[model samples]
Target: MKNFKPIWLMVCTLALACAPSSKDEQTAENEETSIFRHQPLVTHMYTADPSAHVFEGKIYIYPSHDIETGATSDDMGGHFDMKDYHVFSMDEPGAAVKDHGPVLKLEDIPWASRQLWAPDAAHKEGKYYLYFPAKDQDDIFRIGVAVADNPAGPFKAQPNPIKGSYSMDPAVFQDDDGSNYLYFGGIWGGQLQWFEDGELVAGRKGPTDGIPAPDQAALMPKVAKLTADMLEMAEKPKDALIVDEQGNPILSGDNQRRFFEGAWVHKYNEQYYLSYSTGDTHNIAYAIGDNPYGPFVHKGNVLLPVQGWTNHHSIVEFEGKWYLFYHDTELSGETHLRNIKMAELQYNPDGTIQTINPMK
Candidate 1:
C-alpha cells in the first residue's frame, strides 16, 4: 500500500502554509495605516514643501499640492507641475491631521500660468493672508497674495502679482514689535538666476552657467518688509546674506551650506534662525542672526537628505515645544509626488539645533 498522511495532519500543514506570519502581518498593517515614525501626515493625497505654523493653538500646514503631470523630471524642475495648494491642521502632536481641502488653485489667480510652487500663510489685522509663487503669463515666477478670514481658507487672490516679487518661495516673519518681513528667492528652475543687476535678463546665467565658483560669494535669499496692510512690499527687496563664522559670505561652491531655496525664519530666545534647503546637496541647513533682516552666520544642517530630490520645511513652536515639519517621497515613490511629515526639533543649550536623521 502507498504511504499516506492522516487527514488531520494534512489539514494542519495546509492551514499553517496559508496563514500569514506575524512579521508579514505587521508590514502589511504599516503600509495600510502608516503607523510609524516620520510617516506621512495625510496619506490620501500627495503634498510637499510644507510651511507649518501655529494658529490659534492648532498646527497648520501650507504645502504644495503635488500631482502627476507626465512631465519628465529635469534640472529645472519641469516635473514638479503642482497646480494648487492645501491646508492641513492638527490639534496636537500624534493627533489626527485634518485636510482642509483646496484653498487656492491656478485657475482662480488672474495672472498665474502654471507651476504653483510652495506657499505660506500669515495672520494680521484679523485677516489671514496667503503668500504664494507661480509662473505668470511670461513664464517668469512671481509672488502673489490672497486673502481670507479663516486660517483654513478658500482664499481670494489679488488681481495682480506682488509688484517687486520675483523667483519662488515666499516666507513671512512677523516680529515682536509687529513688523512683518517677507523672505524669498531660488535659483535654477526658480528663475532667480535670470535676474542680473536687479533686472530680469532672461538669458543671463550664474558662474559656470550654473553655480558660482568656490571663492565667489554665494547667492543670497531676498527679504523685504511687508506694508502695514500686508498687501504690498514696504520697500525694494534686499539680500538677506548668509556668512561664515568669520563674517565672510558662504561660497556658492560649498553646496552643503549654501542656500538653494526654501527660506524660513523663526525666532527663539531672541535670536533669529534662518533655515533653508541646500538644493543640489539635499540638506536642510541654517544660519543664525540677531535681526529679521539677516547677515546670518552659518550654523549647521537641521536635516539630512530625505528620500526625494528636494527638501523644504518649516519650524514652529507649539505648546512650549518646537517641531520641524517637512516633506519626502515616501508615499508615492516618485520625486514629484511627495508627502509631509513632522519630527520634534530640539535645540542645544547654546541655541544650536540638533541635527535630525529622518531614517532613525
Candidate 2:
C-alpha cells in the first residue's frame, strides 16, 4: 500500500547490475543509471528454517534442508522435503557468503531415525553447542543437541533424545546477564530450559507450554534460569517454574490470540525486545517487553501474513539499525523452505515496532 513497487525495481537493479542489461548508451545518452548490484548472500538451495548466529568474526546460518529424491511441492507438514541439516556462513552480516561445511545431518545422530529441522546454536566456555528439533522415520519429532569446538561443526548427536516430543523450532539463549536458556515449539507452546550440570533436562513447561502439566511442551513462553552447574534447574530442580504460580517476578506469553510460538530475545540498551512469530507462522507477529522474560507488551504488527507461510526467526541490531533475520515460503514453499532473509525493521522512537511489508 506504500506503493513500494519502486522498491522492487530498485532491488532488481541492485540485484542484477552485473548481468547483461542490454542497455544501449546511444539510446540512453542523457539518462543517469543508478545500477546497484547485489549478489545472492544465501544459496543453500532447497532449505529453510534458518537459525542465524554471529560467532567469532563470521556470521553463520543453519537451515533445515528439505530435499527428497524427487518431490515437487511443500505443505504445512513439509511433505515434499524430508529434513537434512546444513550450515553456511558469510564474512559480513549481509555480505560475502562462505561455506563452513555441511556440518550436520540427521544421520549424524545415532538415536535419530528421521527428519532433522530448526537447528539452534550457542557458544559455551571454549566450545559450541547446537540444539534442534528432529523427527524419526516414525514421524514423531524430538529435540536433540550436539557439540563442536568450532562454530561450523561436524556436530555429533549423543545417544538419546533431548525431548522426545512432537515439536519444532528451537532457540538457545545465553542472556546478557550470562544466563543460559533455551526456547522452542511452534503452535503447541514455546517451552523454556535451564542449563545446569551437563544434561539439558525438562524443566517447568511454564506459561508457554499452554496445556497444564504432563504435556511435553508447555503452552506459552517461560524463562527458567539455569542453576550454577549450567545444566538442570536450581537447588530444587524439580519445579521448572523459576518463580511462583501467580506469575511472580516474571510474566509470560500465552493463548492462541497472542504470542503463538517461535520466540527470540534481543537486548537493546536497558530494555530487551522479545520477538515471536504469531498467528501460526502463516502470518507472523511480534511483542516487546522491558524484561527478557516477561509478559511482553505487544509492539504491534512487526509482520503480517507473509506469502502463504513463515516462522522461526532471528533478529539482532548492528551499528544503530535493526535487522530482522527470518525465513518465508516465497523462495521455496512452506515452513522449512526458510530462505534466510534480512530486512530493516521500522521502530517508533519510543521503542515500538512500526508496520512492515512481507519479504520478497
Candidate 3:
C-alpha cells in the first residue's frame, strides 16, 4: 500500500511544535485541550498494507490481505496461488472485522519459493517475524522470513528470502540499542536490514527510482555500514543520502528527488521522533528527528494527504493516545481498494508533531 502521490509542501519553523500558530490556536503549552481532533478515530473498512503493534494494551493490524475475488491467497505467498496473508486486531481505530483472517499463508509455506509482496510483521525476542517481499525460484523480488508463536499465527516460511535484489516493503524494527532493524523498499526506493536468529546479518539497497527520490525518479539510495554482525556492508558503502537525522546536512542535489520514503521512530520527552511517508504515497508527508537518521525537520504541511493515495504508516501509543499507522485509498474510491487506518495524534506542549489536512 505505498499509495505514492502525496508530495504537497511543508515548512514548520519549530516552536511549541510549529504549524498551528492559528489553525485555531492551542499551543501556548496546551490551551487547555481536551483531546482527539484533527483525524483517525477509525476508517479501516477492509484494511490494506498496514502495520501496527501495541500488544497487551491492544492495537494490532497487519495489512495486505488477499483472496475472495481480490485474489492472492494460495496460502499468502502469491505467484498466483491467489494470495494470502492476514493478521488483525483492532482495539479501536478502524476496528477491523471479518474474523481477522489467516494469520499467515502461502499454504503455510515450505520455503525457498513463490511470491509474496508487502507482508510485514514484527515482535521481537518473544517471537513473531513475518516480513514479506518474496519470489525465489529465480524470479527475484527478495525479502522473506517467517516464524510465529502468536499474534494470529500459523506462519512458517524460511528456506530462503532475507537478502536483496528487488525487495518490497518489509519492516521489522527493534532498536534503542537492543538492535534488530529491517526496512524495505517500494514504489521505487527502499531497503535496510539487520537480523540474527532469523539470519541475514545486514542489508540495504534501493532506487529503480523511489525513496526521497526526484532525479526524474531513479531515486538511488545505497547504504552500508555494519559489521557488528549485521551480516554485511561497510567495506565502504554509504549513500542513504549521507545521513540527515542529526549527523546533519543530508538533502543532496536535486533536493534529493522528493518521495521521502517510510521510516518511523518515536520517543518524545527526550526526543527521537522521526516519522516518514511523503508525497507520492498518495500524498502524506512528515519530518522530524532528534535522530532516526535524518536531518528531518520538514514539519509544516500535508500531514495525512487524503483525497487519493494515502500510504503505509506507523506510530503508536494507544489507550494512552498517540497514533498514526496509516493506509488509505478512499477505503473504496478505488486506488486498489485501500484500507488500514488510524488517526488520533496531536502533540505540542513542546513535543512537536501536529498537522492535519485531507478532509475535503
Q: Which portions of model 3 show Cα errors greater than 4 Å?
A: 1-60, 63-88, 91-129, 132-142, 147-151, 162-168, 171-216, 220-257, 263-276, 279-341, 344-355, 358-360
Residue 109 of candidate 2: its Cα lDDT? 81
Q: Per-residue alpha-carbon lDDT of model 3 for 90-162, expressed as tens digits?
A: 6675554434566666655545354455566766556766777655564445656677777677677666554
lDDT of 2 by residue, 1-360 (tens): 111223545555555555555557422421343221112245546556666777876667776765544544332354534445667877666567666657776667877765576677877786777777766554445567777888888787666665323355667667777777666555432222322232323653333233434323233543444444333323221222222234442223332224455667777666666666664534455555556556555555566555544565677555566766666554343443445566677677787777666532
Model 2 misplaced regions, further than 4 Å: 1-40, 69-81, 136-139, 163-166, 188-218, 226-257, 333-338
- State model 1's lDDT: 0.88
Would you list the C-alpha lDDT of every candidate in the order shown?
Answer: 0.88, 0.55, 0.50
* Residue pair clashes in candidate 1: none
Task: Give the per-residue Cα lDDT of candidate 1 at 90.
Answer: 94
lDDT value for candidate 3? Answer: 0.50
TM-score of each: 0.90, 0.69, 0.29
Residue range 283-348, candidate 1, lDDT tens digits: 999999999988999999999899879989999999999999999876666777888999999999
Clashes of each: 0, 23, 44
Off by over 4 Å in 1: 1-37, 205-211
